[model samples]
Target: MSSFRRHTCVAFTAAVLVIAHSAAPAMADDIPGKIAEASGILNDALDFSQPPVLPTIEAPRKTDIRASIDRGVAFLLADQNANGSWGSATRTKGLNIFAPVPGAHHAFRTATTSLCISALIELESGGLCQDVAAVAESIDKSEAWLTEHLPNLRRATSDAIYNVWGHGYSIQALVRMHGRHQADAAKQEQIVTLIKSQFDMLTRFESVDGGWGYYDFRYGGNQPTSSSISFVNGALLVAMAEARDIGVEPPKRVVDRAIAALRRQQKPDFSYLYGEYLQYQPMRGINRPGGSLGRTQCCNTALRYWGDLSITDNVAKNWLYRLYVRNGWLDIGRKRPIPHESWMQVAGYFYYFGHYYAALSMDQLPAADRAPYQSMLAKLMLDRQEADGSWWDYPLYDYHQPYGTGFALMTLKRCLPD
Candidate 1:
């Protein structure tokens, strides 16, 4: 019944529509124009720092996707339980904290709720439905349920499972409607105040490098992978963005420190590494003489995603793919995994979603140049497609499906271009 469990996790956050910071409206040949062009490629589920988009570009033709998305939305709405939980989705019936597990009941909370909200938000944002605005009302009901019931099942205090994710979606949903919501300043203030308080508490636990951990935000290492760090970072970034949009200023240091911490994964060649593991300090669960884990798994994973550091360098991109081929994770082209193979599976992200990072990274390449990963992605999608047309274990497979699927679908949307 702690606070972190209360908020929703915003799903489908995507990559940069890189535009220069502008003071005023400018032409397309101007800096704003470049950003305007890039923004068109990105889905507008949520706005990045830039606004304005290109008028037209050939997008991928989705085969039956219109119907697929429509069906998915209808099924979900029809299935929503009377009590507000999706599919009687709640915490699993029993606790098996350790050991690989499977979900018993179809239930969701914190991160799970965020993802549900994300899917609904994305469809609405995409204008997939004739009554696209109804997406807002759906989100409102879901958010109300999460906000009301979080105390019963939320994690107490830790970076990983609860609080940061709670703020992430809560803030994003509110931010999406910030302009409309803020017209009632008093209500907006109350909600913003609630979110900021949680973020403040979560931020306080940040370690020296501005990274967070599942158990302790300040250097409490639970595993030797970048899973929690990157996941939490995404959530925090979303939250930070929401805060800024709402007239509340998040500490610049938060993003600064976050970027710095992320940089820890980088190698000299500009390809990023993964986690941080100090031997004698004995923080996270990683306990080995040399602690053969740092900046490997998560670094490779993020490299495949939209992180600015990984996207800018060709050498880094090649090195990452090479590492991906040679073993799994690559840091400056070095191939390796944590001692425990800890990075093998991160919950909350669908398996195909991992490649979504690769697709985003491939955006830096020409269409011909990007063919390898693109082909790989198409195959992965084919392999994983459920008989039902809806993804079988996507959201259910991970700690939160909304964000993971959102990321993957956006990548698919990008590659397919429609």
Candidate 2:
């Protein structure tokens, strides 16, 4: 094992971090899926969550699926630039912030970190990435930084608003590391301590009914909306997944309460109904509009139990047909008070939730129905990549694009290998 991959089984959730030169685990057989050949599969199609690319390819033959995925891998390798990013090396686009401790004004910005990480996890699972070096380097540095700094989380951020995104980044990095056998026992315990602190901090900041606002608990100022709720939900799910991975799961009641709270907040359309006086449905990127930007992930994660697949599936199906698909592909509403591009940030829920569960629901769908999703997903990655190797940051909610960029990168890395 590489030095970074040195943690043993006792280290608890240790993920291997094979530096570029280290020997790789035997590459798994090629993943079965559609290659990057098609582009217009869903550009004009309607009434579906994604373009029917991979699933359609899956029905005819498993061999074809494997081949398509291999071709896609080649495309990814071909796309990489020397600077490590798949595209340009420009400073990521971001909001400018004046930090108290900096010689330079901290540029407030991030691309879609969440999507990026999501995608990378898939590649790690598939073992097909061609240009893994650049990302591997980023992960190594980030992991070292995370391990050294996880225990210091409370110092960097205190509330959900300030630290929620940061916390999400920390969670994804840990999740990746633990899988590689890097997060040893001490690291796991430190994470546990940080989580306890974060949960308490959230509860303290939340309102009476258990919702949140811009800075902390919701009040007369700005109130909790679906988009913000989704970000928080992502953080909690990360917590739950990590806790379970480390053998220190949160109380069943705590998770249950959070879900129940989410269910109570849902409207007839399945979108979240939030705000103090005004209420509206969550849209693609609408931040604090009359309605909020609630998506399927909230419903999906909120409904999961230790072994309750039925409940989660039911929730996902209901929301997919009603709230999500019914809304046609527009941003679905006007811009709000926050400073954001609206749809760009929030619409990402479609790729992550749509694919994550779609994969789960794969065994159930007809071949034709699923292909478009795969095609659409691949197209989305190509369309969204900034020349600088990151995604555009979510406008209002995500001031720091790197975290969101991380999420986006993760997501793309999962769904599309090349």
Candidate 2 regions off by >4 Å?
1-122, 132-134, 154-160, 182-207, 216-231, 274-294, 305-372, 393-401, 413-418
- TM-score against native, each model: 0.56, 0.55
Q: Give candidate 2's TM-score.
A: 0.55
Q: What digit string (tens of lDDT, one per residue) describes model 1 on residues 147-246?
A: 5754333334333334445555556555554444546877667666656665665566455557553444443343212233543454465456547756
lDDT of 2 by residue, 187-225 (tens): 656656655554554454343444433333333333333
Q: What's the C-alpha lDDT at position 181 in model 2?
A: 48
The per-residue C-alpha lDDT of model 1 at residue 153 equals 36
How many pairs in model 1 have backbone atoms within 3 A of each other, for residues 3 or more apart or on separate chains, i.e. clashes?
Answer: 25
CA-lDDT, candidates in order: 0.42, 0.38
Candidate 1 TM-score, true structure as reference: 0.56
lDDT of 2 at 207: 38
